[model samples]
Each structure stands twice: as structure tokens, then as C-alpha cells.
Target: MEISTKVQIVTKTTTYHPPLAISSFPSVPLITPFARPANCGGIYARDPGDILVIDEQPESSSCYPPGFATDESSFFSPGLACPSGYWSACMESTGVNTITTVTCCPIYRSDVSLSCVDPATLAGVWKSQFCTFIPARSVPVPVTRSSNGRTSTTTSTLVNPGGINAFGIRMVYQSSDVVTASSSSSSSSPSSSTAANLGPDSAGGSGLSTGGTIAIAVVIPVAVIAAIIGFFLLRKSRRARAAQPAALPAQIEENPHKPSPYYDYKPIFAAHQYHGGELPTNQASAELPASSESPVELPAEAQRHEMR
Candidate 1:
């Protein structure tokens, strides 16, 4: 990779101290060139080990190494943690401040811009968007350098971006990354087999994937709805059955202890002789002895009676 070291008039309000003037003197060693992250308000003179935050993208006009970026440049926050390294200034910066990295793009005027705010208000900086704070992930990569025939590998950190929520503003890409990747691969390899491998495979695979995803999305919801409906229907049927009145078997009347109305009364009458009140109608013609007369007889004839 080629690096540009020309000290152009990158900014109107920037200054630089002699690089080696104070290095030899232990009492006054030259300050190392470093930058603060753009979103971290602004940078100030501090110890190299001092922790700081990089909040925004560096300006394009400022000299910057390739592949380094801050929160403002990335559509998402790079997972890089704060207080690790210097962040770049936005392109709107009037001059290059040695304390921060420079942006690689033009100053975003109407669409977006960077400004200085208190550290406590840093979270509020992105209030225009839903994001309250940036979550960054940093990984170290090997950077090999040869100094006067001595080659050494040093670590250069890279940040991986994180996820966003559904409420975030939609990001639209003017062009697809697949096109650039395919073109770059084809140009570098210069092989017929490689070109064929990269051809319509992606399109076909993406289509199939989309179809499968759609099927799953549609089927899962339908199945869940059906199951819910079935459960409710079963519950309703059970409840209706439970609430219904139960039936009982027919009944027959029985009076085993009661006397019958058709019973004969002769058996009670024959047990004891009844006089006047119980006399039979035929007995009324007969005469009975009186107190005055001892015996009263009735004869068949007067003569017959005297002979006897």
C-alpha cells in the first residue's frame, strides 16, 4: 500500500511542532501525533495513555490511513471501545488538528454534521436518531513494516459494526456491494472457472432463500392461528356440554302399606253378635219376652193347644 506524506495546507487553522527538536532532550520530549474521535467533542493535549472517545468520521481532506473510520462514517457504530485510540474529525473542520483523525469524505451539510458538546451530552448527540450510545467491537490485525531492512509486524485495530433496531431510519444504498465484489474478484483472478463460479449462482441462491423464508414466515403464523382456533372451539364444546342439564329415568308409583277400598267387612261383623243396632232386617218380625208377661206363645189352633 502507498501512503502520502506530503504536508499539504490541509487546514487553515492548524499548526505543527518540529518532530525531532525536543525528542533528544529527556526534559522535553516531542508530543506524539494523535487524534481524538470526531464525536468526542474535540481533542485536547493529554497523555498518550489517557483514555478518550472517537465519536465521528474523519474529514477526507485530512491525511488518513486507509480503512480507519469512526462512528459518524459507519452506518452503524464500529464495535471499537472508547479510550483506545484517536478518532477522526469531520470534513467541516477548518484545519487539521494533530489531536484527531481527518475524515475521508466531504462535509455533510444538510444531511448530517458533527459538533462539540459536553461528555454528558454525548449520548444526546444522536437524538435525531434512535441510538443513545454507540456499541463498538475492535479487533487487532497484523501490520508489517520494514524500517531500514528490519521488518516487524505491529497490530492495527479494526472495528466491526453492530446491529440496529426496527425504529432506526432506513438506510438505502445507491449501489450493491455484490457488484463491486464480483468485479474486483474477476479482475484480480483473471480466470474463466472463477468467473463462471461467480456468475448466476448468487442470484439463484438468493431467490431460493427468499422463497424459503417467505414460506416459513407464512406457514408459521397460519399454523399458530389454526391451533389457537382449534383450542378455542374444543373449549367451547366442552363448556356447552358441561352446562347442559342431565336427564333421569322414568318413575313408577307404589303404595304397598295402604289398605284396599274393595275389602269385605263381614269378617269384623261375624266376630261378635250385635243387638238392636246391629240386628238384621229379617230379625225384626220376631217377638221378644217382656217384663210383665213371662211367656207368650203363639198356637196353631185353640184345640190343638188345649190337648197338648
Candidate 2:
């Protein structure tokens, strides 16, 4: 049986990576060696494409696939060429001038295994196997090109400082042809959709918002209920006060009858009555009674009647 494999090479500009401590390791020409105490074989400090023979096997060189470049390190500035599915990490010690290369391979089954080329040398700084490098996110921008391969314009904007976080990114793909990219206001760094979905920059402070909404929801009903109760109580008090009776006037109680009795009226009525001596024959000679105003004297019986 014969084995076949396809190799691809890619390189990306270095963004940020820690520098390699050359003082800790022995120095060699063209190889920045690091002293790793755990490994049996010494690690070689070489560029991304430098070859190294591993455990009785032939040496392998650094490689990358499509959508990637092979020359730049991650420490370089923005707009530098990089490959999809891979991100550049610059060494803090190297100060953006050095590059560390990584290679990856996929297997469908667990029985098949792939290993890193510099396992003994990269014991601390790198692992012994080529594993999948998953990033948190990716922000891609589009550039318009003419028929002659000249860039006419930039149709989409790119946001920077956008990428996967600790959560890791699964994949990045365009949902539509008319999709537009958003660039960061401060710089050319690409911003991620997560920033937009999480309310303008990935700030997860929703507790304040929820608290405000809940407070409003709770207080409005209580205020309405209090207002209704107060209205009903006020109306009931007014109705109770209006239902009471009115009091009687003083003039009606003081005088019970239409007219009052007088002193001289009784005497006049007695004088008009007939007496026994007055029955004599000459009725035409009878005289009319004088006015009380002239001080006429009253009989004893008339006086008793007036007193009563």
C-alpha cells in the first residue's frame, strides 16, 4: 500500500506574541534555541519554514492552506496577509520581529494520529501534537476589484479588535452577498458581530436595564391602585356629609298661633249682653256705650272675666 498527502503553505502577519527568552536556552546559528528541561531532545529556534528531522522520520517544513500567506509574522501591523482558520500570535520577548510557525492536520478517526515536528524542543512553549486552532471570532471585509485585477474600491467596512474570545469561534461565513462589515470607530480593526449583538461593544451589563424595567412594572400598578382607593374614600365621605337633615328656624318655635289675646276685647263683649233692668219699655231712649279710651269703669264680673 502507498500513502499520499497534500501539503499547503500559508503565513500571516504577526499581531501580538510573547518574545522567546534566548538567555534561558543555548544559542545556535540560525536557530533561536530554548532550554526545555522536560524533553530528551533540544528545541530549535528557527523561522516558520525551517525544517527539523523528528524521531527517525524525515524533517517537515511549516505549511498553510488557501486564504493565507507564507511570509509575514503575526507581530506585523494590520492589513497584512493571513490565512483563514489561523491567527497570528507574536512572542512578547521577540517584540514583533520573530515568528513561530504551527501546522495542523485533520483525521476522521481516533486511531489515526498526527504529531508536531518539534515535540521535544517545544515542550513548554508548544504541544507535541498538531491540534485544531480555534479562534473566538473573525471579522472579514470585502474589497471591490475591476476586471483587470485592480482594486476599484472597498465596498464593506471592517471593524478591528474583533475575534473569538474564551468562548471560541466555530466558523465564519457570509449569510448574503450584500452583507456589510462594520469598522471600528477608532481604528481599522475589524469588529465582530458579538459586539453588535451584545449592545454596542461586548458589554454584558444588562442587570441595570432589567432592574429598571421591573421597577417600573411594579410601581405603576401600585400607584394606580392607591389613586383609585383615595378617590372612592373621598366620594364616600362627601356623600355621608350631604345625607344629614337640616334644623328648624327660631321664629316658628317662638310663636305657636296666628294672633295673640288683647286686654279690652273681653269687656266689650260683656257690655253688649242684655241686663234685667234694661228690659223697661223705652228702648229708643237707650244710650250707646262710651269708648274705653275715655276711661270707662268696668263691673266686678267684667273685671273677673278680664283677669281670667
Candidate 3:
């Protein structure tokens, strides 16, 4: 059966407003924890064992073999952890000063131009955009002595025009190793084919050999005996269960002497009944009665006599 009733419907319209947002960006830069040495116009010197960024798109730019690099330059710093980036060329530099392995960048990754406060403070000595220190060289000029008319000359190497005396730096590249492996695949000899039985010796794979056959022969009997023993044990257990009587439900005997978790009650006074004004007392402990023990006599009129 179905019942129908008339009803009125109502709808309401509503409007929504977007929320206001406040955006901000921090000006601080992220710097590595490594210590920086100050000298060349606040520009840091290249440190040893620095990981260089890799330019992966061009394989030749990476730590490839000498033949694969651009201009056939040998890969430098083969001990570096990662692939050498844009600069992959290697060199055998002969100089008394050390050739530091390094890469330069602004303190913050966001700053691509490598411009910063310390590096910017030095105008000519430090290249802010490139983030490098311009080392100086001392070329010997004619020096005249005041006491004696004698001329002397001394030479010192430093940075000159077109990055001449800039401190030498080398980038570390990933070590490239070559390995050769030959698979034991039977080759279709150009000399012999199906017409001639003289074919290249086929490589032996994990085929069933004498040892494997012996192992299978030894394992089958042991497996069969184990299965038979397991079946018999299972059947014996079933028979034992069928012969046994159903076990009775265990009786949950509660502890009658279990102490109350809360506390022990007034054992003697609560259990025994006493007349009015005759309070219970502990005679052994010499404790006085809690109430007055004086007995009061009832009037003759209040006394009633009843025969049972």
C-alpha cells in the first residue's frame, strides 16, 4: 500500500566571498656549514673534495673518457663523488701552489648571479656575478738602487688581463670504469650450420646433472617416508581424540579469603549487635567506649507486659 501527502517546498539563495591572503618571502640565504677563508676581497677560496654539479643532458660534459669529452680533454679529479658539471676538461698543472678542487655559487640557491653583500663589497678584486676571486701577479720591472746605481728585477705571478693570474682551481669528476662480460651463448658459426653437425660447443646450463639426479633420488624416498609418518601421526591423533571423553567445564572457584581492594571494614562492631549507649570497644588495646555506657531505667507506665 502507498500513501501520498501534499507538501510545500522552499529554497534560499546565498552568496560567498573569497578569503583575503597575505603573502611574504624571507630575504635570508641558505649557506653551507663549512668554514670560509677571508682574503681575496672577501671572496672564498676553493676547498678540496668539493662535489661539482652535473650537466647530464650532454654525456660528453660528464666524467667521460678522454676521447668522449669536448676538444678531447681528459676527465679531471676522477675521485670526485658526482659527475663533473659544465667544466669536465682535465689538466696536468705544474705549479708550487696547490690546485684546489671546487665549484662556486651564491650563498642562496635562489641567487643565480652569485651576487651577495660580502662578494659585492669588493668591486674589481671580486667578481660578484661569477663568484670568483681574482688573484694578482707581480711582473718584474726595472728597480734602481739609491746608494748604488744598480738595477734589479723580480717576478711574481698573479691575476692579469683576461684571468691570467687567477688562482688555479680544478673540478672533481666521477670515476668512469669500463667492464667487459661475455655470455656463453652458442654461436651460429659462419663455417658450419644444420647441414654439418660440426657446431660450436653449446654452453652447459643448469640442466639435470649426475649430482642433481642423485639428490632427487635421495630426496624422494625421504619425502615419501616423512609424508607417510605425518599421515599416520595425524590419523593416530584423530583416533585418540575419538576414543577420549568430552572434557567437563572448568569450575571457577572464587577465593573466599580474598581481601577487599578498597579496605577492611569494622569487622567486630559491624558484625555484632549492641544495645543503645553500649558501644563496642577493644579491651586488648585499652580503648575507651565510643559512646556513654550509663544505663537508663524506663518508667512503670512505659513498661508493658505481654504473654507469649
Among all candidates shown, the one with the greatest TM-score: 1
Q: Compared with the true structure, what per-residue lDDT tens digits does model 1 show for residues 1-308?
A: 99879766753332223211111112211122223234333211112222112222234413222233333333311111111121112212124331122121212122122222222333433332222111255544333444566756455453434211111111111111223323343333211101011111221111222123445799999999999999999999998997664321111125533433344324445645666776665455767866886787987676653554
Per-residue alpha-carbon lDDT of candidate 3 for residues 1-308, written as tens digits (9 for 90 to 100): 99999898975533211111111211111111111122111121122211111121123322222222212112233121111111211222234223322232222111111211232343443332222212244432222122245433233232343121111122322111000000111232211110011101211111222233445899999999999999999999999997665432122125545443345534645656666886655334467758667788878788577998
Higher lDDT: candidate 2 or 3?
2
Q: Let me know the TM-score candidate 3 reaches against the reference structure.
A: 0.17
Best model per lDDT: 1
Candidate 2: residue 269 Cα off by (Å): 25
Please estimate how well model 3 matches the true structure, expressed as its whole-model Cα lDDT: 0.27
Off by over 4 Å in 2: 1-208, 244-308
- 150-257: candidate 2 lDDT, tens digit per residue: 435343322333211110111112212002212112222222211111121112211122223445799999999999999999999998887653322344357755
**Per-candidate clash tally:** 23, 37, 8
Residue 165, candidate 1: C-alpha displacement in angstroms: 24
lDDT pick, better of 1 and 2: 1
- lDDT per prediction? 0.29, 0.28, 0.27
Put the candidates in TM-score order, highest first.
1, 2, 3
